[model samples]
Target chain A: MSFKTTVITILIYFYAACGATAQEPTNYSAKNGLPTNHVYDVQEDKDGVMWFATNRGLVKFDGKNFKAFTIKEGLPNNDVWELYLDGKKRLWVFSKSRYQSYVLNDSIYNFATSDGKTISPAPIYEVDNALWLRAGYYKFDGAEFKVQNDYATFYHGGSQQVFQKHGLNAEAAAVSYDFIFNQYFLIKDGELWFLNADGTVLKK
Target chain B: MSRRDSQSAYRFGNLFILINDKGIIVINTIAHTLKHIAFKDLNIFIQPFDTNQKCVFVNNTYQISVPNYLLIFNAGFELIEKHPFPEALEIHHAFKDSRGHIWACSFKKGIFLYTAAQLRTLYYLKGKK
Candidate 1:
């Protein structure tokens, strides 16, 4: 082979040798104009906009443009934990304050917001519009977070699954893209826990 | 998976919050299989027998930033290949699929399907001629 051909061949071979590795991250922080660098959770809104639950506040990012919200914005709480998009495309945010708040789709309300009472057995996800929260020992007002007789019925509204704290203040759990068959998971006791439809935790 | 290899890998961090901080390492499964456990690494439950198998996997990429370098490893854990990916990508996952496809996911950059000589080279790694 000619020297030029050999050199090009070697270059191609060298290039191919280096392309194998791991994957990359798609989301960006304030570097991408988000409100904060510490983003706890991110979910796609109905309109395809991405909402970030940040340490600073709530942020909405379209392909272009970013909007931020915080306690100053009349939100009952500012420290957000779980970020959920409901069946109606409305947004629900759970915070460390224990209150659950709701925002309508399309941000139509500039003057109204739904700030529910401090919820114990804090929220996890929204399955079909109902809030699927953890049914652990949580209390509201003076009621310590505890489970009651009606606790069984709560899972029907989606609390049937059990998930453990992944780590320090982690609010996300494993969600099977296939929602049915009850295959979602969370790490508990060093084992993968699957929330059974019958309110039982199964080892994965 | 075996102690034979240097397990000398660093943790990978993701810039996207959509993903949680995970424990992911890009390893040549074939090399792990070859160095120690015989038929086990193939995800095989049964069947055994082998010498120093070259194993599967074309290469592993070690990126400090984006699409970086393709790393090749021999039976002795020596790097025998080094390919560069200049596409400026962000990958998410890497492993062999059920269909013998060597898959890799980019961090929203896009997924790559190995075709042509790259796939050919990977076959050569897994004992395929």
Candidate 2:
């Protein structure tokens, strides 16, 4: 074979090898010991164990096998919605029933107020070691959540006119606020608009 | 957009990531610059709260789950790699474990695990003539 033909052959083999090495993922489902296939969220504990919140129950995967926990194991409900791992490694489980519970020492416990009232689920924000909900702030007092007054306040102003003035249809936009930067981000019709805290358009 | 259509914005370091059914927009909050990537196939199953888990920052790269693909972008908002999933699988979120394995949760199918190779070095073996 000619030298030119050999070099071309080698280059073709090299490109083919590169394409074959692209990663392929492995799937796990009910056929492989998962409690159910409808997994809502996944989180990793401090011990490097993966936990998944599913419609049927909460699952624990130890890199090899899947172990599931259900209402019988103390979950508020089987339809788990979300899982959050706090700084202390506590796994906070949110159920579709709007019940908030936390996993400590492998046991699921529902969150309640100090007065024994069930607390409603909301967007939880951790500020200065306290958990702040949309309604107010609460702190865990060894056994239950207690209300705290020193929670951080979030922005909730009506800025529809500001968006409309900037040529965006406010009714068709979705808005989110950044507390740290004190800015508002609006998205509509595949365009993103940025605005200052005072509702002045910064960018489009 | 329907009333139930999901949309959200998250702050990651100096960048703010905004997602809707249309596409994803990444804004550099400090520089007041923005970058938008339109989605070819829209995944409307994305819940508003699920946005917090949609994108993960690891090894200075952002791994975002969009429809049936996991896109990896550099810090400067440049697409470095794209990993496609089965058309039947719709990824809801992607998380990178401490061991560097990416675990993707699907809407109907089960979770998928991708163990990325640590190094990619090519070698040529010569055969006897």
Candidate 3:
């Protein structure tokens, strides 16, 4: 073999040797410890335990094993949507079927409106200090969730008018708060509305 | 070493990987060479995320998730494997955990766990207790 040809052949083998080794992944499914293979959300708690929210149940994993929880275990609903950890280290579980909160020492608490309306886990978000959950924005006052009606009014920069949330022609697509400017922004029919700290209308 | 098209960029050792809507561009800082890895046949927009740079997988790193596929490449910017997920309509986000495992969210189906060379499908199912 020619000297240059041998050099190229050795280089090919060297490159192949440096490639990744063929190692397959280890899967855990219903056949194993997990209650079901389908997992909507997976989160790790402060204690390092992994929590899996599934369609039929909620599963907890401690690195090796899986423990399932559902309505039978005091959870409000079976079909879980997402899991949120609030500032107080409390884990809040949202579900399209039901909503619940879990504390380490305390038991799971069901969430509902003051008027006896069960909060559905659809448009839930942890914005600023309080949670934008259910049909209203609420915060945990160390005992229960209290809905805040302080943000009842908002401004519209396009029409140059202010409208209440219950106004006849008022339509709100999405609502969010901006921490930087300490204001609330709402998207209504593709128009941006900014609200001051006191829920008063602000110009765009 | 510089690419403006990518929304995210990652550096591994002497190589810099830039990803955008088109494909991944791998640049070797020491060699002063740029190599483009195209996935045009797949018809998917490629994006890059921060991962363990020393995982010893593709490119002395790990895997990256495309919209419907997980592409694993080597340090030489060569294609290692293309793991497809037809059920995953769209991937909302993809990131690597502290355990060197890549997690991708499908938004509708469920989250996917990609570790080693195996793709484990975690379906969103529920059980009572």
Candidate 4:
């Protein structure tokens, strides 16, 4: 279908799915709650409430209403890479714009951007008690992750933007983490996946 | 790929040799149509949980399918033994959780951890905001 049609269809689908999972939840969205289109990360609190990391804010979805957290109020950054709910149910975040994190105690961890260079970020996931994160140029110890002295992948903004814009809305874009397979996968754009580690499908 | 295989019964596919959920290094293929394909030491046709839409049929001593909940297929693919899990209507994975119950998910039912012995539904995700 056309790009505009596809985008419309996707938004419709998500709105439908929102109420399809929980029968009695008060939602928070762009209209009455959180702002911005980029929902970068999502997590569930120990209380079973859910939180969404968006481009402008962090949204807390308590199955009834949404409460948004932003830099002005007390969020680390606007561009979050991933959201992790640790064993203690504290929220840990990974970001692409700046170096920052959120602790369970509602505190913010901030890092400054001193150099004139912009650092690209990468995928982040939580394993065990520690956090495993990859920055576009390299792995960050969570301090100030700067661009490499010479040149590197992490410092490449153009490539990172392309990767970030590749239709996370398409079915081809959905990613599932298989603990058993130990690999992150999703159908490549325009590629037909026949048999996946999940199940087999046949296109007519 | 479709243009090339438009008239054929099958098209080019990817194959990965899985040790089954067991430990047999059997071969597997991810293709659109398996009826027209041929192979050796073939067992059962099952799918593994890879993020990609593609599916693989590793082996078939006792086949596995997640028609139920969401959790770990954690150990990796094995074809030798049958590990008991929640019955899936279209499940990719499942969990027994803390209550000796099987929590299964469905494209129809958002999520639910079931009662013991697979007799009834205990808790399900209420889908309405």
Candidate 5:
């Protein structure tokens, strides 16, 4: 073989080797013990049990086996849209069309929302002993979900209005209390902002 | 007549909504009775997101033609927005990510990521050749 052709062949082999070494994500589906292939959300609880919210039901993967919970198994709705692991270590399951709240303890427990209305499947955050739920910030004290004081400010209404206290224009993505800075950190629209105790934005 | 090959299903209030080759099917989970609505002109072939928070409707008027437009329905099943698909992409399914981004899949092509804030198709993939 010519030296030029040999060099070209070696380059092709190198490229193929690199492509073969690239890792591809392992795809899981109904065939692989998943309840349904249309998994919307996934979460891992404190106990290391992986939960998957699928179109058919809620599936739990304990690294070895897959357990599915459906309407036949006492779920009010078959379609599980979202899953959340809250501060209390409770697995909160939200459905697409149902008003009942399904929580996972030793098993799934069904309960009604505070207003007997369906909660929108959105992001849920725990902050200051309360929950930043889709509709608004609320405190669920076992029996009922109570709306917090700063509901109007904390709740996003799709408007780009600056909050009165924080002077932030966007809605908060997540909030965390920083012990190092002795302040509260608010992550909103990918930007991090520090807040004072009075909720005013602290320029930093 | 019953439509076969269901793409997706969701719950709206007390009704279990299913999207098949037909437009939309509403079934009462408790009564196990199908509620028929006078759904006209909407040949909904897909139910992109599992969450009833939003609905994306695609119409394929021609049997062999690709859909040109997409209808977005809010949680209430009201028409919220209508988007035209890019020139020749055939979308099969779509879903919302945890970050609230809408992603659509194509049978021949790969996937497309759409951002609501930008009101445009942010990314597209034609899949590996």
Candidate 6:
């Protein structure tokens, strides 16, 4: 081969080697021990064990194997929608139809209010080192859920006006509050803006 | 626009990720810095793996149903890896485990495992061949 041809061949081989590093994703389905093919959410626990919420059940993946938990194993329903791991290391599972459950010691049980009613899935907020569900005014005392009628008081007042005062169309902006950090995040006109609870812009 | 089509914000540590019609905007509250990525002709959604977890899963789709690509970001709000998937696989959310393996949960096709080695390879594969 000519000298130029040999150099070109060597460069092509190097380029191919670099492009070959990104392999196709490995699939895991019912054929591979997954409970079902419809997965809704994925979460990892403190121990690094991966958990999946699926249409059929809640699946536990320990990197190499898959284990599923369904109604027979104490899940509220077969269709799980979301998963949340609280500060106490408990796994909270939200199922279809708003039924919520938590898994402790590898066992699933219903999450109910003080009156024995099932708690609907809502954004879990941590306050004062305790977990509270913004919807239905429920608070988890680490043992059971209790009613907290004045939970709305915890939210910062006049937060919407804060956005409007800053010349942002509050109605058009998507705003979310970080209770843990006491800050507000707003997305307006394709730009993200961060502000303090008192309406001072932190970053834009 | 429907509620699902509207913009949404999720917090991972001090980083705030906002998903809008244009793309994603990430802001670091402590550093007072911001980064934005515009994904043309794609709808974006984000779901953090856990409350304390510092990683965010970004699912990019076409027409809001067809899976197009997946982007994972670390605690510092930097794009760690990006991978394209089959359109048939509608991934809802993803999580990166402690071992650096990415677990992508799909709507009907099941979960996909992408190892750290495979993710690192994609870094070199960027740009036209």
Best by DockQ: 6
Model 1 clash number: 28
Please, what is the TM-score per model? Answer: 0.38, 0.65, 0.51, 0.38, 0.43, 0.65
**Compared with the true structure, what per-residue lDDT tens digits does model 6 show for residues B1-129?**
111223444444455555654566676767766677665523443333222112233232111111345565454444545656555656655666667777777767888888888776765465543
**lDDT, candidate 3, at B51:** 24
Q: Write the per-residue lDDT of candidate 3 for residues A144-203, one digit (tens) a residue.
A: 556555532222242223345324143443444432234544545545556665557665
Runs of candidate 2 exceeding 4 Å displacement: A1-25, A86-89, A112-157, A161-168, A172-174, A179-182, A187-204, B1-5, B28-32, B39-53, B117-129
Error of 1 at A21 (Å): 11
- Clashing pairs for predicted structure model 5, backbone only: none
Off by over 4 Å in 6: A1-22, A96-99, A115-128, A132-138, A146-148, A151-169, A177-204, B1-6, B11-17, B24-68, B121-128
User: TM-score, B chain, candidate 3?
Assistant: 0.58
Chain A vs. native, model 2, TM-score: 0.60
Please give the RMSD of candidate 6 to the true structure. Answer: 7.2
Tens-digit lDDT track for model 5 on B57-98? 122110111133445554445545444455355543344433
Q: What does the lDDT read for residue A88 in candidate 4?
A: 50
lDDT (tens digit, per residue) of candidate 1 on A1-204: 999999999998875664342222233545666665554444555665656565676776655677777877645556554465555656666565544465654342222112333442132333333334443322221222233324434434444233322221224432321122333334333344444544354444
Interface RMSD of each: 14.6, 5.3, 12.9, 13.2, 15.7, 4.4
- lDDT for each of the candidates? 0.38, 0.65, 0.51, 0.38, 0.48, 0.64
Error (Å) of candidate 6 at residue A65 is 3.6
Error of 5 at B36 (Å): 49
TM-score of 6: 0.65
Candidate 1: interface RMSD in Å?
14.6
Better of 2 and 4 by lDDT: 2
> Which structure among the candidates has the greatest lDDT?
2
With candidate 3 superimposed using the best TM-score fit, by how many Å does residue B115's alpha carbon deviate from the native? 4.8
- The lowest-lDDT stretch of 10 consecutive residues in candidate 5 chain B is B57-66
Which digits, one per residue and each the tens of the lDDT, describe model 5 over residues A30-118?
A: 55666565655555566656676777788776656778888777776877766666667677777744354555564667755565665
Model 2 TM-score (B-chain only): 0.66
Poorly placed runs, candidate 5 (over 4 Å): A1-22, A97-106, A147-204, B1-129
